[model samples]
Each structure stands twice: as structure tokens, then as C-alpha cells.
Target: MEILVCVKRVPDNEESEIEVNADGSDIQRDDLVCSTNEWDNYAVEEAIELVDEHGGNVTVVTVGDDESEEVLRRGMAMGANNGLLLMDDAFECSDGKGIATILKAAVEKGNYDLIMTGAQSDTGAGQVGGMLAAMLDYPYASLVNSVEVIDDKKLKVGREIEGGNQEMNEIDLPCVLSIQTGINEPRYVTIRGIRKVSSVEIPIQVASDLDISGDSVGAASARVKKIDYFVPELGAGAEMLEGATEEIVEKLIEMLKAKGGLK
Candidate 1:
């Protein structure tokens, strides 16, 4: 199938206390423990499974700095055939479209029949896959939960819509899909597996190699800028519930009755 799955490395939210940086433009990441994006795990798994049954290869790619190579290696450890690293100082602080432009250039460098991305990253923008599809002028789908190969040229895809309804459609090959989590159980990658692929060559592409001019990308070219990144303050009269599930449930019940929400 020649599938290309886009993955990302992000701070493990569960392992750290995330706070807006002093600049307010990003989070404090200096001490953060980073790992592959959770949703992307499902995307990588789905792509590998598809290629496994269809007799083809899966390539995992990401746009990040040198440290980002670990996620690529992790994907390879999960059965992807190859890894791609798109690294460049010019790509720093790029907006959704700017990031998409870089990804579009990388996509052009391959002969992939399908491109997949996580529905959303930690940033929660969820804009890369759709924007990349638009830039490539290819058919696109988002929140895809299921995909079935009908033939070499076609696929039956199921997506989750509002109200939690599932809509199915047939999309042509050479299209893009934003994979939703829970689509599959991502395989566990042992430390040994990662060490095995540590020697595999992963090509790194830069702005010059992709023909992307300096001014057209990076912070200066970014149309959308993050002015602030802070967690919302709790509203008035809000009480926090703490403890085990059973304790929380009892507290909720007491609060609801006291508030006249239940009799």
C-alpha cells in the first residue's frame, strides 16, 4: 500500500505538570519527558496492519528536531518499514499552514498511496492533516475509525461525526485520513526492538532540500501566533472532587442532592 504515517514527539502530559512558559507562546519543556503522540500510535498501528495484509510497506515521518528521531525509531520498532525525519531550524514556531507546507513537501518526496495523521496532537489544533490534504489537492477524511481495502484503488472508510454517529464512505487511493484513537490496539514496542532498528538509516530533510524558502516558513511566516497558553481558571462556586472512583461518585451524589439536582 505504500502508506505514510505522520507521527510526532510531545511531552508526556501524564508525567509532567504542564504550564505555560514565561513567554506565554509555548509550554515549559526543558524538563519534560517526551514520547510519541498518543493518537499517532493508533495511526502508526493502523498503517502497519494495513500494509501487513496488503503486501506493502509503511513509512513513519515527523517534523521536529534531532531528538525527535526516537519517535521515528519507535514507529519502526512497531513494524513500519522506514523512518523519515524533517528537521530544520527554519521550521521552528511554524503555524498550522506552515507545518502543513513542510509536510506537503515531504509527502511529495515519496510515492505513498495513503497518508495518515493523528486526529489531533497535544496542541489540539488538529489542522495538519486537513491542511496538508488541501495543499496536496488530495481527497481527505478526518476522525477515521475504520478503513477497509476494497481493491488496490479504493477503500471503505468510517468516520465519527457529531452525536457519535458513524458515517461510512468510499475514498479513492492516494488520499489522506486523520486517524482517531481507539481504532486499534497499538502494539507494544520493547526496548530491545527499538535498539534493533537503531542502526537503520533515517534520512533527514531540511528546508533547502525541500525547496522551501526561508521567509515562506518559520515564525516570521507564521500567520497564526500563540500569544498565550494557560489553563483556564476554574469558574465561581466550583468544588473539586478528589479520591477513588467510588468516593467521587458518592460525593457527586451528595453534592447533586444538596444542590437540588437530585431528590
Candidate 2:
């Protein structure tokens, strides 16, 4: 059971404010603190648990610049066997499909039985896992909250659906699963574990190394383009309508008639 878990570095914006950059297409990230994507931590923990139970190696992968290595190291501290960093300037402007292209190339290079990723990123794109699965032509499931390995080549998974429903299915191995949060509690990275893995060298893979064309990734290959980006303005304050129900209704009707809202 060689599991490949894909993680990402995201801004810790829950405790901080977000500011749009000058280009109006991205966030102002210079002063922001970065950490593992919250959902990806659950994915990492699930992978680690699977490996611990089945006796296998867990390799955590991330695609980003130099700063991305921090998340990989954190995964190692959480008990991943190794780490792979997919870094290149060409990846900077990649849209969902472009990213999937690069990831598929790298995943094909490895002998992995199962691939896992977060159900959605903090950026809220939520498209990579499905795109990657399509690119790999692998069986795919999203919003997965539970996994049970049936055999060396099969698995039974439980997915969360709307209305608090759980959909259960059995799928073949060599598949991709987008893990949702609450599947497992992620273990904290201890200082000792971090120190131990500090000296472990993480291999960086570039687009060329993965045999991915420069034109196949980045902004040029992107299927979607950001025309503009801006935060929504705060709307007008609420108005209070206090009195008895009949009086309130009468006042509302009068106001609506006065405003030409009613015939």
C-alpha cells in the first residue's frame, strides 16, 4: 500500500484579514502566515493511518514554490515516510486543469496504489482531485469521510452527501479519493519529530523533469482566466420593524405602496 497524499500550503486567514493584491487577481501574501491547508491535514492524517494499519510507505507531495516545503516537512513530522515537492515557476499561474496535468505527470512516475487529496482547498477551488482523477483515468470519489481497504486491489469507501447522508461504494484500487474533514483528527507535529526530519532532503520535481511541456501548464494553458478580483462591499444596515404582527404588516404594506413596490 504505497499511498501518495497531496497537500498544499495556504494562508492562515481565519485569524487574519485578506487583502487583494494590486493586480486584483490574487491576495496580498507578503505579511500572511502560511500553513498546511486545513482540509489537507485530514487527508494527510488519513494516509498516515492507512499506512500504519496496512504497513506501507506514505509519501506526501505538494506543488508550490520554496515556501511549500514547510508543509511537506510538517507532513513528515506527522509520520509520512517521505516527501516530494513539485516546484517550478511554470506552475505559478496554473489553473485547475493545468495543475492536474502537472500532478498526473508526477503521479504516473511513482508506483502508488492509492492517491488522496483534500475535498477542497481553502482557496475553495475544489477541482484538483476530480481533474487529477480524470487525467489519470482512475476511479474517483469525493467528500470521502471513511475508507476501508477490502483487499490489495479494492476498497470500500463512505462519502458524505447533502441532507446528512452517507453514500457507500466499493471501488478498485489505484484510485483517487478526495478526503473531507472530520474523517480523522490530524496529529500535531512535535518539535522532536520536526528536528528528526529536518535533515531529510526532499526531492523537487520541475515541469521538465516530469516531461510536462511548459505550454501545457501556467497561465497560457489555463482553461479559466481571472478577469477581475475584488471583495464585495458591505451593504446597507438592517431596518427594524417593531410592533404587533398586524401593525407591522400594515406599516410594511404602506411602505411598499409608497415605494411603488406594490400595485
Using TM-score as the measure, which candidate wins? 1
Among all windows of 10 consecutive residues in model 1, the one with the lowest summed lDDT is 225-234
- Find the candidate with the highest lDDT and give its number: 1
Score residue 182 of candidate 1 by CA lDDT. 91
Give Cα-based local distance difference scores for all models: 0.93, 0.92
Q: Can you tell me which runs of candidate 1 are displaced by over 4 Å? A: 242-250
lDDT of 1 at 4: 92
> Which parts of model 2 have CA positions greater than 4 angstroms off?
235-263
In order of appearance, the predictions have TM-scores of: 0.94, 0.88
Candidate 1 deviation (Cα RMSD): 1.8
Candidate 2 per-residue C-alpha lDDT over 1-263 given as tens digits, one digit per residue, 9 for 90 to 100: 99999999988888668899988878887789888999899999999999999989999999899989999999999999999999998888899899888889889999999999999987698999999999999999999999999999999999999999999999998999999999988998999989989999999999889998899999898979888888877567646678999999998999889889996
TM-score, cand. 2 vs. native: 0.88
